[model samples]
Target: MSQRQRYAIIGTGALGGLYGAMLARGGHEVHFLLRSDFDHVTKHGLKIESHLGDFELSSVNTHATVDSMPACDVTIVALKTTQNRLLEELLTSPTRDGGVVLVLQNGLDVEADSAAVVGADRVLGGTCFLCTNKVGPGHIRHIDYGRIVFGNYSGALSPAAVRIAEEMVTAGIDANATDDLLLTRWRKLMWNIPFNGLSVALDATTKQLVDDPHAVALIEKIIQEVHGAAAASGIEIPETMIDKTIDSTRTMIPYDSSMRIDYLNRRPMEIEAIFGNPLRAAKKVGAEMPRVEMLYQQLKFIEAMRCDTC
Candidate 1:
């Protein structure tokens, strides 16, 4: 592996732009697979402002379509679940080859989706713990800690994974490769399933949701339900993990969940991938998820209404 791995970020949104800009600024050869806004990004460059600091990149390689992009060693996918079909197109397109597709998406089904397109050996499970959003075209505004966790789903950490972790660390972002990749993914889901629904349903911030008595109780109920479902499915999640998630939310009180932002902006939400997957797993385990199911239905209805209005 070379000291600097060539990186291609698939979705140049908030988290993707942040990390891509960081790697490019750190002297790595980075390219951004963008959409129709490629000309705008190319003209103005990518900008990122965060609680940790601020940085900008002036010479970012931007591609409007994957068909025009060069083959890279690693491709980081930061798209929402609704965009998975598009990702399928990219992975199956002639432009794709033997590169590792690191999915930094929310929800638990990223591996399954990516594996269907690219082989399991080429798919990596990744989760990003950060509060970030696009404040403008080609600009990402980060609000909290930015750390990336990734690993192989087959329980084997490849040398490529290690090299990617080292490159992320060199860019001043914390990255960890773990043996228990599935467990880490489920843990992150536990946080997203409850908090994301509550944030969207109530239009509340992380602090407000975790601080309110009724909201806190609701979140706890959802967490316990998810934990029960996970246990039934043969995943061991520590009891203390729920409390730790709550504490983390307390510190990130001002931060708004991505679901909330998506709802406010009238964008498609990840209700199915984030909430529906766990609900289905719970059903498979014979565990009841009344509250979680109710929220899921509510979000679906909300999304329907948004579409109807448009």
Candidate 2:
């Protein structure tokens, strides 16, 4: 952006709070759009407990509503995909002329919603390889990995995108830009399809799921199905990605996935964005994910039952 652009974070949850706090701590002007923690954050500010190092921002710029936030050069959407319906208002409020919407979310075929608001050329996608969650109001616990890979939804990596990645690095984050958005999404799904789904389906933590031999085999099957789906869509995810993802998880701290937390907290799960959308993309190209499809339906049923009970 021009002359060190301003930033606005739409969701003040785990990923959003961690990123926005780092940016603000790195001497950037960041306005956080908050719902629940507005009073706490606006008063006590944000507390980030990270694996790298712990830090706190005692005074932060926070707003309760989107309309109250200033128009910024880059607006990061760190919300779960279940809330994409608000993209129309969320994308417009914090973005000024020539500003871009950076989507730090999961799933495929999802950027179209942001594009529909701000035009395709101005929508960027970020794949977050971070293990983080909100432990309490305005407090985030970042246990492992905080690297972000950014790419333009229009398949053109702009100088602004690279600048944003570099700024993230300046904020003590590991980040970079990529030309292949689709490839990055597919690679993420390779890990999400198995760990996130099984975490909820079996009611297990990442360590629990990866520890059992039988469960590991099942995860392998789900990964293979996701790989096949990607291949049919003309995206070639490396075969070694499977082992790499699983191996990385083995070394990760025992944790619950976002889906597991959602299910437990009675919050909505992002089944459509994480599972359904990818399945449909594969279906369009005559690819089927029997294993992943079965898991998807199970999640849908669980989600429906959970909502009904709640």
Candidate 3:
């Protein structure tokens, strides 16, 4: 077996916990830098109920702060963009020279922020196509689909990206590496723009949106706008991805989007990253995304209300 790389999970939410646990299970030295659930995770360790399988780590390295953790070969930043203000402090501590920072985040231009702290050469963008949630402290429920498509922010796959992809594949994650990170980011935005937006704006789950014909049509319209936006920005998303995304969602387990979950939990939503940033990027290139713009406005209002009350 190839040597396992030491990994640090910067956020122990769904993305961090699931992937970090899999890495630990694959025999990698994994350290989880936790926060609110630090005591629980420290005592009971990590627990995951995944479609792939159920697993438990009775004893794993857990730390409350980055300063308490050892430097690692790869650090996965899975924090929601809402908490990104903390990145300037949290990103630099747990990585070593020549180590890579893998950003498993949502929305556009996320890696650049990480790159600002870590050199651009040491950063990789990982787009996760999965339905998993942290149901409780130290516990995550993986609903379905766990494929992670990796791309380099520098426009070409680097050795670090390849090594991380190989490690993920060994850990049982459906992983792939792509050369065009911008194209890959646009591809992810194609799905994220409509579903995450409508799911929160309309107060519905993935199933509800797909089952209703009216909602389905709206989704298609939003997707068309996204395609135009991508093209306006010089990135081309295939026309067929719209149908494929809708069909895939139709078959997914009745799941609450991360945005919807945030809405229900009264936490701040990731409006800027998922919707606002994409909208600005589109408008800069002369693309008119009326549907997306409207959704963005609604979400902004909803985000304000959620924050005010919570």
Off by over 4 Å in 1: 93-96, 308-310
Model 2 earns a TM-score of 0.97
lDDT score, candidate 2: 0.90
Residues 1-310, model 2: lDDT tens digits = 4567799999999999999999999889999999989999999999999998999999999998888888899999998888888889888988998999999998887888899999999999989998998999999999999989989999689988999988888889898899998989999999888999999999899899999999999999899889888888889988998888899999998888988999898888888989999999988999989988998999998998886433
Give residue 54's lDDT in candidate 2 (0 to 100). 98
Against the true structure, whose lDDT is highest?
A: 2
Instruction: Give the per-residue lDDT of model 1 (tens digit) for 1-310.
Output: 4567778888889888898888888788888988855887999898889887888887789988877777777888877878888877775542247678888888766678878878888888888888898988888899888888899856589887888888889888889987777677788888898889988888888787877999988898888888877888788999998888888888773877889888888989989888888788779779888888999999998898884333
Q: Which one wins by TM-score: 1 or 3?
A: 3
Query: Model 2 residue 98 lDDT?
Result: 93
Candidate that beats the other on lDDT, 2 or 3, i.e. the better one: 2
Query: Residue 250 deviation, candidate 3, in Å?
Result: 0.9
**Model 3: clashing residue pairs?**
none
Q: Model 3 scores what on Cα lDDT?
A: 0.89
lDDT score, candidate 2, position 232: 88
Estimate the TM-score for candidate 3.
Answer: 0.97
